[model samples]
Target: MTFSDDLIKLKQNRSAQEPLPSGIAPYTCSAFFKSREYGMKPKARRWDHLLSKESHNLKPSPLKTASRASGQKKLISLGTARPAPEYFPWESLSLRCLQDTVTEQAQPAPTVSMASVKLEQPYDLGVAMNYGFSGGSPQALRFVTEHIEIIHKPPYDDWECSLTCGTTSAIEIAFRIFCNPGDTILTENYPYSGAMTCAHAQSLHILGIEMDDLGLHPDDLDHKLRTWDYTKGPKPSVLYMVPTGQNPTSTTQNLIRRKQIYAIAERHDLYILEDDPYYFLQLGKSKQALASAQLDRTDANEEFFKCLSPSYLSLDVSGRVLRMDTTSKILAPGLRCGWVTGSSQVIQKLVSYYEIGVLCPSGPSQVMLYKLLDETWGHDGLFNWLRSLSLQYRCRRDNLLESCERFLPSDFCEWNIPAEGMFLWIKVNISGYRQTHTASHGDGNVARYLAVEDRIYQKAHDNGVLVSKGSWFIADVQTLKGVNFRLTFAAAPVGELDEALQRFARALETEVR
Candidate 1:
């Protein structure tokens, strides 16, 4: 049997030995089932000095602290105002989930259910409806932990995982924990706009490092850190990136590039916030063919695992990487479920924030995920589903690329084929417009460029094709130097994608001319 089979077996053995007596299992970490037999790995170095002033002052919620005692065996006397499971209105829950396969034809999805009966299901409405610990319910936590271990096995011994409401919430918690007001943070030239706003709300300064086709340039990052001026407050201690299928740019960092960036982070003592929502959506060159080949093999799960790009977490020997993962891309976004994997100390700090804030992810979401991820689809099943999903997205990406080639004017627009993720970044050549329009208008080059971008965006909107302005994703709007638009292939039908591109092409022609 393969390594994945061994892991599933380990999980099953553990589950059999520790059945939930009263529907609630004790809060646990990855370490519970994580094999320590692997040759001696160094422990993660302490990061106390890197924490924010706010994080330093944060105290655990008293009620949350006391809730832990309720998990003890045969200890029934509860001091906290805990609700009886009998009072929860939900008697049972069920889900109709797709079968784990990569065939071309549609297959019948199976129904998986969880009832209040502990014997019927290990996780059910009883534990799900209750106010649980900030770390999340043990069943869901274990599945994610094992998932992380099987996939990106962090090199350090102290790595742990905790559930989050979603990647957006995880970003907020991470920023709060690591950044202070007036502190500087480094990010890719173009980042997820929501993250920039999150940082700005806390009065943090963001510096955008130059990037190439492969993603953030390591030399640019090193140069920025080495030349950081103290007059602008402290040097940036955190470096945020989307690493795989990077937002707006749709660039995936190769292993060599990732190692180069990690070395720079090590040299600068920087903490890397890896917000990789599109990690699983990594569609390699000719992904549909690759998926077919893998599914044909008996070791499809192991082969699929081998094909994935290595995560920053896998390279984090010092535990400087806080990797945030989400179900928003792989699963339905409405689930509002995600997870963070980092050093134990960092994870504990995040849990403290959760206790005072959201308390925990929606218990219903957690239980549903537990049922789906842990009960219905095990680790192997999830890998199969992801492989199938990646193929579907790849086909969508192909449709968009084909549309761009067939409709868009070559002289005015150029785009790199996205290797992964949902977006296609188009670079509009506005030099002709700049020469003809900006020179005549007497407006500064930046203003003229932005004006052109606005006109193109409005034209596209009027033509019934909505595209994201590239300028909106820039970390520093003052430094915007290009007229680019981000188009997504994730939404819209195959036929509509072509129509949308045709409309966008017309808009570009009308505006740029």
Candidate 2:
């Protein structure tokens, strides 16, 4: 305890410790910026060593600026933030182009527009060939923004919209914007595997919340956040879920449940990445004809329309929710056009991301889409298209369910009839099968379950029927409470649905036994 003894102990510790590498020097009190003599310019000697042997003759790329004596200036922008002139309000240009395309059959067509700002048919074609230049066109942005406001009705000032290549890019942008590596994100019991890939690829930790037939369980979500084991990591700051026509499950969250989940996110200061591509494909009531028995058909439709579950974006007041929508469902998947609506802060980042990623949707696709939806179909026409699509899907869903009932035995399988979306999610539990809930599904015997699921898939394929294994859509199949499979009523021919079900039944019998 004496001063001499303490000095001796410190000397002994310093002698026992390892020394730094041969060439490395310790950083003590170094001045990064210090004024030297002669005009107090940067200290030349300190940075002179960094100048390459290229002899300091390297000059930056020269901008093609007109001579200073010239009256007109030709300033060109080569920055990444170049103005997206192609995205300007081009419906008027599109209509003119369409009309001219027909009118100028005999006239010599000018492949290039002589004018700088005004675009013609040739311009449209050129843009289509290489669209998404400098980001989305202005008109494309307008249509995306207008659709969400008139359709979904997010708060005007609190939210903004941007056109993305598709839902995948939109989600990837959101992940990068909202989450950092090692951050926790709350996901549903069964998440869209694509979104899960984006999350895990970013090295984010995912916590799966319990879900019911109606989708994410708010009570369980609240409990998970409130009594979180921080020792695992930090509290989840983002919630990734699908409110309508949940993937693989084909379930939609009712309005009350959506409200509950929103409240929990608010309480936990969580940002919601609401991915709802099936919002327009709601199917239940369309199965039973409009109640035209009592009310007029129009009135009956209004009632059914009102019955569709409200969106989580409708309940988010904190501007914490960002929604991803795609035309892939209602329109065409190859168009690669989708949009996100959320707080300005995140949307701005997403736009920047798009500029670096795919730039924007194809120019022709955006223009043609805007013309088709806004100029030709209009909102009313879109609604009509959706109704027709829904009716078709509903019939397919009903037929598949009936076929399943007739084909698969109850003891081996069960599924709730989904009121919304394209697929029928059937729980495939062979009789006497009771799975034990052990560790996190990630560490469980997922490989074994995957092998089992793959056998069923291979069998179904061999029988000329294709079913998506539920494991593909879930975070971890081993911890799944039940064996499940997703059969799409959307893609198969209507007459073939029943036959497909028969084939699925055969495959299940072979594997489940």
Candidate 3:
């Protein structure tokens, strides 16, 4: 099995109580043990720490158990933040009796409010359902909110967070909040298909932005916004992008480019929806390992983390960035739990809509993840898991990368070293793609690019190779002239990847000239 295979097994079976029937511990010698130790890297000596490489949150997030219990009391208390709606008559009467009993005993009986009592109950779905707006449990909000502050180091305390299924829901909510039907959503040239699906479902238009190695090209973004014909439709107010380890392309936007994009957004009045699910899966550790030949594993981890590109949130001074993080990438997708951080204005509207539809994330998912991420691992432990996860994917990434070059026809296909994310984007060069085929699709002599692509894709599928056609992600089919495919390098077994490539190569050879 490849590192990717092993990694999946470890994550899926993480809930297992006993050793696997194989008697091996999950992730034995997983990258965590083999790679560097934990902690962020040292920054250059500087007066203003803002620009320094050191983590803005140099210290670990304090465990909010005790602190938040006290705070939750005040928030839900009388004359505090909006008090939770009064309990139903029967529920309040029962609570009153319990308090009366305590008063008779002359003891400060645990204040038996419906909301506070729910948290004190043992973690149970039924208990979770008893209170909480459709939004989520207050504890969940408290946890993820503090977590966002720790990682992204948002400068404003006014920002609020809401739990959702994942980035998909976050994007949809943002769409509902900031845009109406027919409004356009701008994203990278090859955007995440799922988001596109959601946009199409709402009768919204998707505007594709050109991207480069660093990520969304500032010049292209500026040009697209400045020249966009508003008479044709509403000006795109949202720039939705997966800046870190972007799907399909596996691109990470460097700090400079992120700031550039943010600046352009300011000029254009765009809300940057940073849908970065793979933020923690930092693949640059592989490069760090090679570069730090003299450093130990811990040192390598520090350097790897230090060198990671700063997020858009870090550069977002005006709270213009609505950032979402998921346990799906770091934990399990089936959990379907993630959080969104944005300005109070955006969050209020998002939460208002969220209440009417999928009220909040699943209770069981929140319960399990809360236990795993917080109760069990805490901050340092979670970081360790992320580092190790990156290493395992790195192993898989290298294997498929080498296999692509070896199996594909060198004359037509081109591959680049992808630092992060699951898929490797392969550009396929074909004759007549631009001139004859695109200009006139029906002519027999002119190559039908889509037809040829369908043949190759069908051939691969028939031969047991599932691959994604790059055209599916293109925003402008008319302008895109080349053929390409997005192959997963961080999934499936290594052996399967080799066989899949062999099958893919055969399909290419048989179908394409």
Candidate 4:
């Protein structure tokens, strides 16, 4: 079929029940920076005006004096250091404070000395005291490789890994190295907001393929490539996908889907950017224990594990696939440490981005994480910790699900129970609520007026809950429907989840009442 023919058929085959887009107007230009499209209406888009007003609150401080003040002989202008805000934890506590706390807490007075920059005795403490390899300390990479071997295997011993600041920096580097400006990248219609934003900033053409529960519909993917207008422009240079615990949507692509998607990428010679931050966050019971030692060198071997599925990195034969793994969710977000494993070419490119961009992520953060992992948890221990975490999050997900089911109006809110990841993407039926309204106001009923006003994000925030609005993810602002929002169960404590849900329900009730 022709490209146009395929596009028509795909649109027709989309779930007929899908609601029409209802949020703001289509974006006039890319919002790598803000735009005026949402500001056309004076009152309808007052939020846009408020945002503008807030942007001007910061002024750049004058540059610091190059030379020291001479003997107070009329000390000239040296930029004043503002007293650090209470919120600034870094200013309040120094590294020395942490050392003192550690020292005081030790029962036997810990042998490790906090006084010196370098430790003289035992256990190669130098790694902790010193800077590591550019790609990260060798031990971190080895541990990651070992983890990958146990989980998602690299193919043919051909793949290599590099440490990135985080997935964001890795993706930015990937975009820069593999594809040029105006290159086309295939992604889900509602892709990761960060990826979409990055691609936009780089002037890459994002070809958003429609997604289903499984992920990018394989048929749609094939159709796009097979039916593209090569005559008019270039074929897609890269295909970006978040197969496991996708952001915003929280959908996990099954192996059946991966094989098909991989096939399409291979057929089209398209680079596959498998940007999965929550790869290890798969929310299900632990799988049958296959000895970690028994696993092959490549993480590729465990691709089809029944309970916890492996990644696209495992399925890749050609070096086209670039897999991003992060410690943010599993460890702590503050660490800002993650790794990218792919072809040597890809790793080299990302290394260059690291060299020029931030040089490397925090040296101490890496050291601390590395030491914590090596000392406390070896490979097996780390795996077990992740499994325990997965279990905890699973319980959290169940709680969030239960809360929504109990509190939300049955037909009013629609969402998919995510198999893996934190978010539950929900859509509210604004029009349905409009049909029934008793007029309390002189002019019109409150419910009728409220139906026209979307509360996907605002209502929740006002009620002491917050979620990412769907409009933030959609590229075409005109196509955005304000009805949807991505709610997370990750941050909130389990005890508070029900209360948060109650707040969310009350927020919605205000409109109906």
The candidate maximizing lDDT is 1
Model 3 ranges off by over 4 Å: 1-125, 129-131, 285-301, 432-447
Model 4 lDDT per residue over 93-142, tens place: 11211111111242332232222212332213333333333465554554
Of candidate 1, the 10-residue stretch with the lowest lDDT total is 17-26
C-alpha lDDT of residue 183 in model 1: 95
- Each prediction's whole-model lDDT (CA): 0.84, 0.63, 0.63, 0.60
The whole-model C-alpha lDDT of candidate 3 against the native structure comes to 0.63
Better of 2 and 4 by lDDT: 2
Worst 10 residues of 3 by lDDT: 22-31
The Cα error of candidate 1 at residue 68, in Å, is 0.9
Error of 4 at 488 (Å): 0.5
Model 2 deviation from the true structure expressed as Cα RMSD, one decimal place? 19.9
Q: Candidate 1: lDDT of 218?
A: 96
lDDT by residue for model 1 (1-513), tens: 465666766666566555433445345566665664433788888998999999999988776665564545566645667677777777888777767764578575778777875325555677777777788788888788878877887888888899999999999999999999999899999999989989999999899999999999999999999998899999899999999899999999999999999999999999999999988775667534454555546676676677789899999989999999999998889989999999989999999999899888988898778777777877777888887788778888988989999999999899888888899999998888745444345346677778888888999999999999999999887788889999999989877998999999999998896
State which candidate, 1 or 4, has the greater TM-score: 1
Maximum-TM-score candidate: 1
Decoy 3 TM-score against native: 0.73
Off by over 4 Å in 2: 1-123, 126-135, 285-304, 433-452
